[model samples]
Target: MRFRNLLLSAATCAAISLSASADLTGKVTFSGKAPEPKQIDMSGVKECADKHPDPVFEQTLVVGEKGELANVVVSIKAEDSPDLKGEPSKDPAVLDQKGCMYEPHVLAMCVGQPLVVKNDDEFLHNVHSLAQENPNFNFGQPNKDDGKTVDQAPKTKEYIRIKCDVHPWMSAYIAVFENPYFAVTGEDGTYAIKGLPDGDYTVQFWHEKLASTPVEAKVTIKDGKGELNHEFKAEGAMAPDTSDVKLASMTKTSEKSCCEMSKKVEKVATATPAAKPADAQVKAAN
Candidate 1:
């Protein structure tokens, strides 16, 4: 009986040790010369221009003096780790629109997590999502402090681009993952993904302007800790095209509703006769 009891106690201890979790910390840096940020022209919107007393440059690529890269997303690829399934957090991730720009230009969240969007600017701003995998949403926030909660989370892993139809210059990216092991680098270029179980993981580093594809690295977590450091080449980095004139042609305002345009199109189609085939017309003429 004494031997059996000792065996049971040993098994319990081993199980506890195997179930322990750890943290993954890392820093992302830039190796080459960073690109110059373009100055945003907000002179058309008086309210937006008044908010920024000084010139505001685009945040396509932000690098520190020490070559620390900011706004890079660090995540554990779901395809590589089958056993690292993590529950989504109950708290919602907040994205705020202030001074005609989205705060935290890059956001990473787990699947089934809620997203709260807040508009702090006094003027009208449209929240539009250009998601191919998930359902797209486009709504207008006319008043200040207009907060909307997007309760439905993405079912698949994807990088979604969010933009403001009213303000063509305003844009942001939301990265959705299957698990919670993802972190965004801050202005200091540091990121820490906590509560990860002990195992080997394939980590991916992604920056919007640096490369079209994500950089991958292998990391092993043991004894409650793991570290990874990566550097991205800043030379030849390209910014996303956000031409106001091109985007304006694709957007429709509330003044010209979709139903109204459809009715006009129907009337025009009814008035115009269909053209006969070229062969039939030639036979008739002969």
Candidate 2:
């Protein structure tokens, strides 16, 4: 009986040790004044323009009134962190297109995790991926609530750019990491990376406008928690041009009409028979 009690106690202690982990939390702030957001012109597409009664501005740099910076990618460097085993989550990260713009200007996901691109608009929008390390994909979504699951996940770590060819001003970024210790700053500029083992790590903070320069910080995690705060200088930072100078005139064909035409063409092609070879035709005639 005494030996049995000792074994049970050992097992319990091992389980508790295995589950010991910590979280890294931080906030990113802007130091100087931010640039004025550029207003986007959606007059070329009347349907899209009508959806927004007020003017929409570019999201290149979103800073709150209190200098909270949003859309910054925060992650722990893979080299400083231990390797993660097993597969990533099967649940997909979703990116939605609404009001002629991409929601959540920045997205972060573990390598090999699934991704779903959704269209919440009633008009046509093409998803074009400008990926250097991963395969590029471009497809059109013409109906409302159209969702497409990407065939494969990114195999390498990279920052992929997504764009809508139809909408010249539509753009977003996707940050892929080998490890799962990454988070994007929200409107409040806060982020938390959970489940990190107790150790020293190097954290990285990246922004789109500040692509040329990324800030790094060293942090030591103990006792299940670590806190970090960084401030980005905003001087000489320029926002991207959001004007629709290259927008063409709107097309007359509606989404429904276009879809119906495509279905009819596909059905006709499948039902049609192939022509006989010329030699067989000549033999039959003879």
Candidate 3:
């Protein structure tokens, strides 16, 4: 009887050890000024003219905090999260290129899952896979019908890239992972990954800018729930456009409809010698 009791105690201790392991948790907040908005060349973007109407740029709707924090991919490489999701989804993540932009700019998919790239616009696009861990790929496709869907998949690319030949402005990148334990921060700058094994792990924060070396930290979780607070403070992670990155000018411009805005500004300047007052300009810049 004593031996039997000892074995049961050992089993319980093993279970406790697994559950008692530390769980890392935290949040990532942007602590720097947003990059300046870039000036998109309206003449270049509107090549098709009548076929595609000029898009209107809505700063508030298109960008968040001048894109300082939104769409940042934060993940935990715990290899354990993959065990939680029932086999990978059969349906591929469909990314479409329409009107010189990639729909769903941010995408996350598990390893081995198929990814479909479709050119919904009236021009050709290239799926340029910029992957260091996986294989590299770059291929072009002609635009099909508006409803046509392309059966495109990249087997290897730690992270993939897709660009358009007809529209240099069109671009998209896929954050591919072997496991499904990942998330992209929303406009509010909050992220959560459920189904973690209730333990401690390193959480990685990555951003297009202000994020270098994958700001990492040990997060402690409580009661099967973990909250991580992290700050990505890299000063020049994205690196200022020292080499004329096409956007060396304005900065974080989006392609909705800024050309029309330029027209308004030009018109106002022409009509009135006194442009917006310096104080008003300062207020507007803010």
Candidate 4:
């Protein structure tokens, strides 16, 4: 009985030790004065305008109270760290549109993982993705509480920009990675990428405004968790263009009709030929 109890205690200790090695935590900070927030003119759509009684601002550069920067994608560039292997999560990554604004302005997900795009507003929203390496799509969700799960897995590491046709101001960025070792900085400018095996890695910090040049650092995780911090300046970073990204003017009555028509078309495209369910399951299981 004593020997069995000792074995059980050893197993419990091993489980605790394994859990400790799975975490990677860090913070991203800003070095320069944050750019003045850009004003978003929602006057084009009355419903969207009314939803925001307060003046809405563009999230071009979201710097926290401290020098912390939010929405930065901290990832282990797969090519640079070939030995690092991360399994994608079973649950799908979400990109929600609420109040005519995309919540979590920046998103990072593993390549081939399910991306669930949702619209939570009462008005029409068009989810148009501009991706070079992956299949590009432009579709609308006409009603409230509508969602579309897209399996348009990217063939390479890329950044896909999502825009709304009905609302010209709405835009978001999705950073697709080959591996699952990535995290987007939160409000406090902090990020955590858990479940990484102990090894040397090349960690890349990417932000929408600084896509042309990403900051890279070498980190060695000896005991499971590796801490990293990066600082970006506002001066060198390029802000996103606010001009019309091929948006055509529409009459109020025709807008709803247009959205509904596109929504139906997209539903057919994504529904019938169901994406590789078996592949996604196998990848997640690994």
Model 3, stretches more than 4 Å misplaced? 1-27, 45-68, 79-86, 144-157, 234-238, 241-286
| Cα lDDT tens digits for candidate 2, 67-101 | 88899887777765544332455777778999999
Compose the digit string of candidate 1's lDDT tens values, residues 1-286.
Answer: 3432332233210112323445677787776677667899999989999999999988878889987878888887778776556556667777889999998798777777778889999888898887667777788888886568875556677667789989888988787877777889998988888666656777766666553245555676655677776666444344345454333232211122111100011111121111211100000000
Winning model by TM-score: 1
lDDT of 4 by residue, 62-97 (tens): 888897778888777677666444445556778899
* lDDT: the better of candidates 3 and 4: 4
Backbone clash count, each prediction separately: 0, 0, 26, 0
lDDT of 3 by residue, 32-73 (tens): 554454543446545433335544331211234633355556
Candidate 2: misplaced stretches above 4 Å? 1-20, 236-286
**What TM-score would candidate 1 get against the native?**
0.75
Best by lDDT: 1
lDDT of 1 at 19: 33
Q: Would you list the clashing residue pairs of candidate 1?
A: none
Question: TM-score for all predictions?
Answer: 0.75, 0.75, 0.62, 0.75
Q: State in Å the error of residue 255, model 1.
A: 42
